[model samples]
Target: MASDTTNGTRTIKITGKEAMLKNKSYFKTSTGDEAGCAPKKGVVTSKIKGKVYYTAWSMDVKFEGENVVRHMDLMTHNHASMPGNTPTWPYLDEMAVSKEEGPCKDDIKKEKEACKEFTPHKADGPSPCPPDGKPSTKDEADAYADKTAAKECLRARRCQLSPYAPTGKQPGCCPGQTGHHVVEAGSFYNVGRGGSNSTAIEGTANYNADKAPCICVEGCNQYHGTHGLMHTYQSTAALNSGATTQALPLEGGKQTSVVSLTYKQAKTFGVDAVGKSFPESKCEPACLEAQLDAYHNKQGIDDSTQCRSIATGYKGDEAEKAANAAVVARSSRLAAASASAPSGR
Candidate 1:
């Protein structure tokens, strides 16, 4: 279970009277179709009995004043509170620790080959966005693309995630590429560096579900696939089920929502992402050069200095200027070397 490591212990508490669980965002119908559970008043009732209990561990808990924003204990949501028991005050319940929030030793052991290849891509690592993950400006949004890039504001530090490797590793890239958060990290589920076991931020749940959205990606989702064509980590199928929301924006003022992926479904989609390939569109000279430069610091990986420039569709920035100049200089050096070499007969 992901824990609050602030002082190094989960600051356990009896959920106060007002703590209310949000509707189960994603669920399976009796026939097993992915679907969403909505709150009638505030509580979500299971339709399929033992099969459709809300993903208690994957939901947010709201209290009168002590609202929790992170994921809850992972389990079969089979337990039911007493009829008169509101699950609030009077009689109370303790918050469950984060379920299998991210990859565990067993998980790692299961996917060792994929684990060995895990590398933190620049785009997938920490960025300048705030802990809430809501960027006030477009620059903070996604400077690489334009307004509304669907990539999750993957700002959690590996240290922050403690044991989890920032949502099943994909080891590579940024700007042109992005980290797609499988379980919607849009709001509180998306920010703050609080320990999974403690509330680092007052009045807010500790930010610890590195394993909650443990699912690798709600990817290959073509909901708004045309927005930026920026996501390359997945492309297995079209998301036709689960809860959908236009959580983030994209280039050209377009937007897209995240489709929920269950643990089993996530496994089916291959959390390792080992077999995925870069988007065919992103393999162009400029995109490739920028990606290579980001991955290996080889701006001159190819003779192209236009990596950043083209990747952002010509969005000018100071880094782009310097990068372009460096590429140009390298190109010149290569030309001079060619001229000095003896020609073949």
Candidate 2:
């Protein structure tokens, strides 16, 4: 049994089964009156040995005409109230009481008028402030001029290699030529001469007046001849000597400026040349060796002797053919061994 002595005057006893059931109607008035029942106020409970026990109360209340029951926690002061039969029965008394006085009508009207006086006005037109101006420095002006000139050049399909001239050079103009030429070999022919036709070729090279072999021997063929002819000659030389594209420094502080190609480019050129010169797939080993040499040369590796030996041992397509033959021989041997082996009955 649990006893709720909330007001210290009225005591309501609730059994263990009733507490378990928690029937809210048990606390209502049994007389069937118009106002709903009011349960004992602030009924605090605890559970001991699986049975609910009433402990204490925080609020005091009397069962009146239309008041509903409310419980408030003694420690936390949290309030809870039961539902009422009338729509506003629980808040009727509070609603009937006078509320705190608000601002008067005249005061409200005066406040609105004051707010209206200070309100911001919308602008009649766009801002009177001017837009930001461009930079005025010489460098900025020059850059803008360059950009405009580049755009003009691009529109005209011209090359803007030098920024000094607004109207840039033509698409295929040589260094000193006004018009495009089919071949630019005039510069290379006057390499070592000191007359009006002379042009300096930069880089270290030994020159002899008698033979005049320095320019060609130093491998400046690209500068001396057309690109297609030079490329063909470079491809042939690389295939002949398993040397990569790297330039080798000779004695007397001079370097051999060799024309170099990437591995894929070298392989393509070699394969094409081999197919034209020899039977189909007959010089594949040489082509592969050339590609390997190009790769090693590009990486600056120093294994020239070993690479040359390997290429020589398996020249042409001998390496690939030998590997295929070995595979076929192994297959035949395996088939023969399997045939001669004893079979289980």
Candidate 3:
């Protein structure tokens, strides 16, 4: 087909007039199919007004795809782009709660709001739990009967991923996955398994402490064994690597999510070791040390990475490598913390 700029019309060519597009077949370049859950990445983004915008996808991304899809779609995906949250949980803060805390309150609140929901599937997330968050009904009880679903549901609820193992689990909750949270889940006010350190994770919910997801996983795999993954992943983007929505396919599994940090967000880091220049990232020793331990935990050296977490600002990407890394690292720590499944030993 051709267009005439002046007349607004032009001659057109049709190659498959006699056949359907699918029936034509010759246009096919490859065979493709869509299936499976999407993994939480070290980075994430959304599209806004035809422009690309970056920010945390959802805090409840133990499973990916669904939230990413919701954020990537035409209708739901940012008629806007990133960070335009409502109100804060604590009204307005007089003191910084998270040791890893920085600015970007609106972004943090929005992420916490997003974390309220989750993917309704076996992968990416759990089957939707009760809107009221109760398993008192027979149907609700039955729904939670599925061990995996219960865990995912708890994850969706921002509760502990697993409650008991041979050990206690870190509070795996966070908008930024830091010691502080953008919002509160009952008592998840501003604390993590690591206490109130800059790198501590937001702890699980107070109510679901005895849920099936927490109980079933005990005496087995260390729960939150892969937390290092999300802990770092939810953080990235204070860099130049923000994601491209064109690349974020909702139907696919595990895409290499990324974020593009703004120079403005970068300036928040203040100055570098030389004191004459600003860094592209806001690297906190506590957070950096956590990332290094996560990388060194699994196989070592670390393909896992995170930059400028939500604690600093929502301007980076996250990856799945941290999950695999923490599995092995939990080996020695199992006596203290927990994993969600069998330790794979």
Candidate 4:
């Protein structure tokens, strides 16, 4: 006798012999060709009386003549909710049985070897290095020097400035030694003692200055090297002659919306004529507040819900204008209402 649980609630108790005889109708139909059962030879159905029961089958057993040997669990879809209450095809039960074993040791080793040899695709080509040769401006040279120093600092085993590194006093191996220090302006170390006191130079040396000539170190502070000095002189001459001032193109130029520009870009446009060409460079809320204050003596309306709604609802020039209009309309309405209303006193 065997007891089977269908759908985790109902328990079915029936003998193997009784189940076979009761569900004899399903036995003929349940095969590999008809119901997608694994083995074509075995009887998959287990029923008691007219109702279906669960039967276990195994792959180890094979059929021989009249003596039919069923192996593994012959799982079937339970139609307990159906009107007829007949069990569906024995496909679900077959999935319970495991097929292949886990991957062997050799297979894992081969995967590791393949992964080691694999080269990832690079969309931007080789790694980025700081700008080489001398930069035209002191700003550019300073920028290059900082970037190169940061890169070298990152490559070293220990970086004093890095938050991830161990805290407290620690010596670093990089040149321009003043213990381990982060590369930045105003960082100084003792050079020599003068008049019974120590003299300190407020700068560090550029480690890869030859390879990366734009790297401005302590020595290049006065002129940022010969190339930088030449560029500085040339830039000054150009500026004096109005050569540096580039007029915005009036026609046959690309038209882009100003709303796409960042807050800083918009602010730059407001302050500098160079950004005036971009029509879409409208200022955000803070700038809008300043504009409202200047035009209407209003400061609080820019950050209000109504103003924000109007701003977001419209785009580009329309957004700024609409927001301003809404603020004005609201203020007018409030003023008119206050004037008409009777005094409470």
Candidate 5:
């Protein structure tokens, strides 16, 4: 089959019978397939009315076909090359270094800047307890009870209550197996083995010969009997004594006095801030000291770890470490002052 140049007319130059045979397979290829085969990338382009146009277009991803199929296809794969021929994070060092200083240098400088301030915070009282003969009359006893309550409350807030221990046991209440309770029971016989109880009647009242702070309207009602007027705090946060209707004497059990932590102290203690407050209650000296020591010694460090980690990631842990370091260094000065106080131990 041939095309005449003048009018683009197709012609067959052969005998009539041969021409007939040629016409039968005029558009056929060697593989017995049709001519004008489609391109592998699909759809061809054309210039119609002097404007470029496409017969069709595809948006699907380019897939790699077998070598045999690729050879048979008309289109070539230009996209199947290295992805940009370079790593994605090319400027990693620039990103990490941010400024003229490297990350390590910046960290050191940051640490120095953090330590610029040098003034120390004033210390706390020696102990939560008062003078030896402090709690005498009902008013004095109530005051003592209140102080004790505050300290214990602080302790409970700092330490997590152990699930294995009985429910009534306050946080940090487990001070080893010494069997020495924080607040002893009221009965001389130790009748009620666990939980809050007051001192028995036989226990001596330490009211001194000096002027009493307040008058006793009632006798020593340690167990919340009519002998004394009971002081009640109705907050659900408080522990419940067995007797519901009767107000119990200001007995010690459940926490009373709690440690009040500054942002600094909380850091040192490895405290988490999820349940945080502006000024949170915390543990007493003994328990806090133990915790601090555990943080310090557990890792075989010469001094306590500046901050103990409480599952708040690196930022929280680092801050706590700095705070703890400050507290331990300041403890000696505070202790000296405490020793000179009237009721200091």
Candidate 6:
């Protein structure tokens, strides 16, 4: 039973309505394979005890209006109404709040006491020479110790005490050389086919886009491995590519009615960083939206030929000239230094 701070003082009992809606996304077939349920039509029905229950909560409502999108409650499927009632998954008929429960006071006290003892070890302390009569309090001493420890942790490339620390420990770096260029596990590259006289290429351990395709991250899948080196962060560029308009080829040289984007068009879409391998289904929505927008505007969506033009600043050809001048100036300085140095060879 998780408590949410937003709703305020309300305990959410998992009801049949809620369960049916939540699990609507997951429907199993007789063979155990799952499929999306088609939309249900007309008034919703729930067969109860060989009879019907006209519960308003069970009704699947659809809004009516032009350009208005239809939204269903989380559990309502396309075809199925209320789920088939079963004792194993009984519906919560009612919900009421009694004395709410929370962590025991003793447990809270114990946690606070333990926190006091688990203070991070400090690496430095103030000099014995203190201000006239000011003595450091326990809280101030602990804070100073924590600050010193934090500085040491950063210097040693250890985890920080902050919430965003990679590992949950005193703010210090990883135990070993974890971040000094290491690729994800199970990710490696081969220079060529496995055979005699085959030697791996030099610098084959580092990731270079010119060399090989990106590899999926290991435990934390944000980075991609290539060759032997790893590149941080996967790009979503592939998902945002342009339109496709080709009929998929079927067996026996037949063509399917469905259209898809051409390879050129797909590449034209925003897919440089993410690479070129993705399912047609993934690119369909954006393609269709672009096509629809183009079709709508083909007839000139607005009669007014609204046009405006503006210019700003000089071209950067001058900036390039200035950069070249600076380079020449630096070359002159290097030549002067070389000439002034005494040579023995």
Report the lDDT tens digits of candidate 6 across residue range 282-335: 223222222222212222211121111111111133432443353344345444
Quality of model 3 by C-alpha lDDT: 0.23
The better candidate by lDDT, 1 or 6, is 1
lDDT of 3 by residue, 269-312 (tens): 22111011101112232222222222122111112222122332
Model 2 clash pairs? none
**Decoy 1 TM-score against native:** 0.20
For each candidate, give its TM-score against the true structure.
0.20, 0.15, 0.18, 0.13, 0.16, 0.14
lDDT of 2 at 47: 12
**lDDT for 319 (candidate 6):** 33
lDDT of each: 0.24, 0.24, 0.23, 0.24, 0.22, 0.22
Q: Tens digit of lDDT per residue, candidate 5, span 1-345?
A: 112112211343333322211111121111111113223221111111111111111112122210111101111111122111100111112233453422123322332233223110002213223233434464554444333323332222223211123222111111211111111111111223222442312111221111111111112332221112111111111122121222222223322222111213332222222112101223233332232222222222222111111111122334444434433433443445446754211
Once superposed on the true structure, which residue ranges of model 2 sit more than 4 Å away at CA?
1-310, 318-323, 338-345
Worst-scoring 10-residue span by lDDT in model 2: 211-220
Q: Per-prediction count of colliding residue pairs?
A: 8, 0, 33, 9, 22, 23
Query: Candidate 3's error at 30, in angstroms?
Result: 26
Q: What does candidate 2's lDDT look like per residue over 233-333, in tens digits? A: 33343455555544434334444444333333433443343233212112233323322322232222222211110021122344334433533443454
Residue 327, model 4: lDDT of 33
Residue 284 of model 3, lDDT score: 36
